[model samples]
Target: MVGGAILRKLEKRQAGGEDLTLVTRTSTELDLTDQTAVRSFMQSERPDQVILAAAKVGGIHANNSYPA
Candidate 1:
């Protein structure tokens, strides 16, 4: 939901005639935890901005294993 909200804000900015380049990659296409792949992507695309909104949430059982 946060990611979608951010995308909507960016789209609004673009609609206002700002020169922006938007790029997106699915989980199948990119492994966000992979360092080498990320570095290569940055070198090639050379983007002005980047947003990382990756989230991994486990169920209640998993949450109970952690401390307060």
Candidate 2:
């Protein structure tokens, strides 16, 4: 939830030609547990900074289980 809000703010900023490459993926699309897929994604994208927004703080235990 927090990450998504931040992403929206960044998107608005990028509209002013910040040239930021904001890469984001949901848990379903990019499983953090899979090392091979993560390596492939990082090599292909080569992000300068990685935002590790893997936690949902205000959530129930059942809804906040990270695959790690």
Candidate 3:
């Protein structure tokens, strides 16, 4: 919900000619917990800024499997 709101705001700004690019990826496409994957992605994209709104949402089993 928070990420969606931020994304909407960014989209509005972009539409209003903010001169910025929004880069996004789904969890399936990019795993935030993987250091190597993140490093490779950052090197390839070289984005000026980043909005880290990623979260891991799941129930008991998932929570047990992946503890933070």
Candidate 4:
């Protein structure tokens, strides 16, 4: 999320109006834990760059429940 915000800021600095492609995905569309799907998406999209925002996020109760 932080990186995406930073990217947006950087893009605004450019004078030329460049096409912006935001590859935002909901958790339901792609699971970060699934490496294969991620790799495939990367290959197909072929984005010149990438901003990694997805994380293994959890709540306090969930973290306490699975202390791994």
Residue lDDT tens for model 3, 1-68? 67889999999999999997999988899999999999999999999989898776787899899998
**Which candidate leads the pack in lDDT?**
3
Q: Candidate 1 lDDT, tens digit per residue, 1-68?
A: 67878888988998899887788887778888899998998888898889988766566777788634
Scanning candidate 4 in windows of ten residues, the lowest lDDT window is: 13-22
Q: Of 3 and 4, which scores higher on lDDT?
A: 3
How much is 22 displaced in model 3, in angstroms?
Answer: 0.6
Error of 4 at 68 (Å): 11
Instruction: Provide the lDDT at 52 for model 3.
Output: 93
Candidate 4 per-residue lDDT over residues 8-67, each given as its tens digit: 776785435767765667679977779999898888888887767665657888889987
Model 1 TM-score is 0.74
Q: Please give the lDDT score at residue 16 for candidate 1.
A: 97
How much does candidate 3 score in TM-score?
0.78
**TM-score: which candidate is best?**
3
RMSD of each: 2.8, 4.2, 3.8, 4.4
lDDT of each: 0.82, 0.84, 0.91, 0.73
Those runs of model 3 whose alpha carbons end farther than 4 Å from true positions after fitting are: 57-68
Clashing pairs in 3: none
How far is 40's C-alpha from truth in model 4 (Å)? Answer: 0.8
Ranking by TM-score: 3, 1, 2, 4
